[model samples]
Target: MNIRHYFDLCVEAGGQVFERIGLTDDYRASRGTGFFTAEHHIRYYAETRVGEEVSVYVRGVDRSDKVVHMVALLVNDTTRRLSCTLEIAAIHVDLRTRSAAPFAADVATAIDRELAADTADWPVPVCGAMGIRR
Candidate 1:
């Protein structure tokens, strides 16, 4: 319905990556924890309309003790063009504690595997300060 919704859709697709890495529904429910989006950047290259089918693809970019960086693309299925790009920095946190936490060893290993396997190449948006220039 909106630009934000498009980005959210892409993030949801990205979650499939997490699901495969052991962050299953049961695991999240039992552990009472999961990764949360700490920050995101979305750049739109074109507009999409309702009823148009779009595919989202995500790849692991990097990771640290507290966060995983990922890139996702929303593509127009019919036209085969990228609609937008989303860069996300997600953090693992203890839901109860509401604090940053390291990913479980197995989870970390799985993330590393995805990071290594990600061979997707796309143009990254320029990131820095935003401003109105003369």
Candidate 2:
């Protein structure tokens, strides 16, 4: 599979996680705020060809005042092998000012809750310098 596919899959999965953590676009839009990717690290472990379906698993890894780090895993269904891992650090931004901003109280609490849950359930792999950046 193309490397771009893995990136897209990670973003797709991250979007879902954002929604699950009460960070939907609509909510952000109402507040004139949004999340912008500040950094990304993709670790390729295996290759997949066309017609090979994969499943994506994602979770929040960590967060700072203005940034959130999330990790995504893509696994080949048939082979049951890890295909790729994408870690992204996204900044919460104020749309009008176009600058990084802290997340809302409710949103921050929700994300923390989800992060705690994910941390309890999943073994966190080393996310590298990019993840540590935030």
Which candidate's TM-score is highest? Answer: 2
lDDT of 1: 0.79
User: Candidate 1, which ten residues in sequence have the lowest lDDT sum?
Assistant: 125-134
TM-scores vs. true structure, each candidate: 0.83, 0.90
Give the TM-score (vs. native) of candidate 2.
0.90
Which pairs in model 2 have colliding backbones? 1-48
lDDT of each residue in 1-134, candidate 2, tens digit only: 78888889878988998888777768877899988888888898888777988899887788887889888888899788988888888899999999999888988898888887774554756456776452
TM-score of 1: 0.83
Q: Model 1, residue 66: displacement in angstroms?
A: 1.7
lDDT of 2 at 122: 43
Which segments of model 1 are wrong by more than 4 Å?
121-134
Model 1: per-residue lDDT, tens digit, 8-74? 8888888888888888879878987787888778888888888888899887767887788877889
Query: Candidate 2: which stretches are off by over 4 Å?
Result: 119-122, 132-134
Candidate 1 local Cα displacement, residue 88, angstroms: 1.1
**What's the CA RMSD for each of the models?**
5.1, 1.8
